[model samples]
Target: MADEVSDAGTVRADAWIWSVRLTKTRSQAASACRAGHVRVNGERVKPAHAVKAGDEIRVFHAGRERVVVVSKIVRKRVGPPVAATCFVDNTPPPPPREFVAPVAVRDRGTGRPTKRDRREMERLQGLGGDGPTAR
Candidate 1:
């Protein structure tokens, strides 16, 4: 067993996750527990749950859940890379966001057009080409 220091010489799992910026805040961590968004050792856990090194932890966020094993106990918010060191990612991150082409459109206006028409043109400036709406 590792001897972790705390205010009383011990650390809480929920607090640790909060300080580590895993879930934003301790209360939100607890809310995650209530919502069954967190698990330990393949079982659901509460905010007051106790965790030790080598334990498997999972967290849900942004429409996805992450699973990792406890490598060490840390009570400070570290950089992303350092935070990444806290555990091993069990699953790959979600797919990269990509823009999908919008449905075909027949733009309005004919002559010089109105100010709104010009703004619309700027908005669709990067859709591969000028598009059917382009002049």
Candidate 2:
């Protein structure tokens, strides 16, 4: 909105990130900046850093990284539809999740495993050397 613009035609980094919907809250954006997770033009930035149209911003958050080029600047949070026009997303698709093997579980009443059982379980988990050698 016109009220969200500054005379310099730029907005604070955290505010812009929130306004564009890159983050759920401006505080989170600030924390990310403080943690060195927000970059502008490939250089780390602070929460108060000024961001203008055409700057490339990279944010690492929620276990994923987002790469976006600023298309517009707004200081007030906008709806998703309007927010989408505020940046050009260049983030790659998330990596596929690998299948994790199920962990071994004993019965509820089972007692502590014996040394042999421990060794066998360790072998199954690939944590120890090969199994018992031939006699």
Candidate 3:
């Protein structure tokens, strides 16, 4: 029976991370998976591991991580169409994000710039020619 096929694994953790447009590529997803940062249903798993609808997952990225539940899957790399099928966020509610104004970094004088550096700086500043008005 067609139903006999396992409909399990709504999404592979790596594929989900990859298709959701998280990591740039599937290999990166696998690497991330091997790093042991991803957890399914509260347990660590590998990249090829699969997740099914209602399965929960946790992913740590950058400085912060998120937890989510699998809602659906798109085996192929997906665009915005299947976006909704991917999953649901279930991370523990976080406190208000703290925003700290950055202090402008000043590079100490490392001697005068070479001719190329000066030209590049001039172009960057748009001193060479007319460009879009600086916001």
Candidate 4:
């Protein structure tokens, strides 16, 4: 039935995510849920999990976590303006890029790196020496 599909009061987690533009596509939202990248109220949920207003949702994507509190339920994808009002974003700002050290660059015509140069570069990358310790 139409009411069964739309639910009127609640929406599927993946549908809600895509409808609100949290992800680029509905399929991506479903994939995220299946990969354990989505959680509702601190519990991991599948794509079909019901999402309602006031529920807190956390989505991990693109190396960042997006925390949002649902304020509205929508089943159909909407424009950005409308999507913006569906959730209250609670995610912290990403860390500054300046904190990352610059990578070593070789000049043109420098040819291949010698063993010593490679070792030095590896050390600069913190992947040299003994490497990571075993668990």
- Please provide, for model 4 over 26-87, each residue's C-alpha lDDT reduced to its tens digit, 9 standing for 90 to 100: 99999999999999999999999999989999999878899999887887887788778778
Q: Is candidate 1 or candidate 2 better by TM-score?
A: 2
* Sequence-dependent TM-score of model 2: 0.74
Q: Which ten residues in a row have the lowest lDDT in candidate 4?
A: 1-10
Instruction: Provide TM-scores for the models.
Output: 0.58, 0.74, 0.60, 0.79
- Deviation (Å) of 45 in candidate 3: 0.8
Per-model clash counts, in order, read 0, 0, 3, 0
Q: Please give the distance, in angstroms, between residue 37's alpha carbon in candidate 2 and its true position after superposition.
A: 0.4
Give the Å error, residue 100, model 2: 7.3
Error of 2 at 94 (Å): 0.7
Clashing pairs in 1: none
Off by over 4 Å in 3: 1-11, 92-107, 110-135
Q: Residue by residue across 60-123, what tens digits does model 2's lDDT show?
A: 9998899999887787888898888778999998766655554667778789997777766776
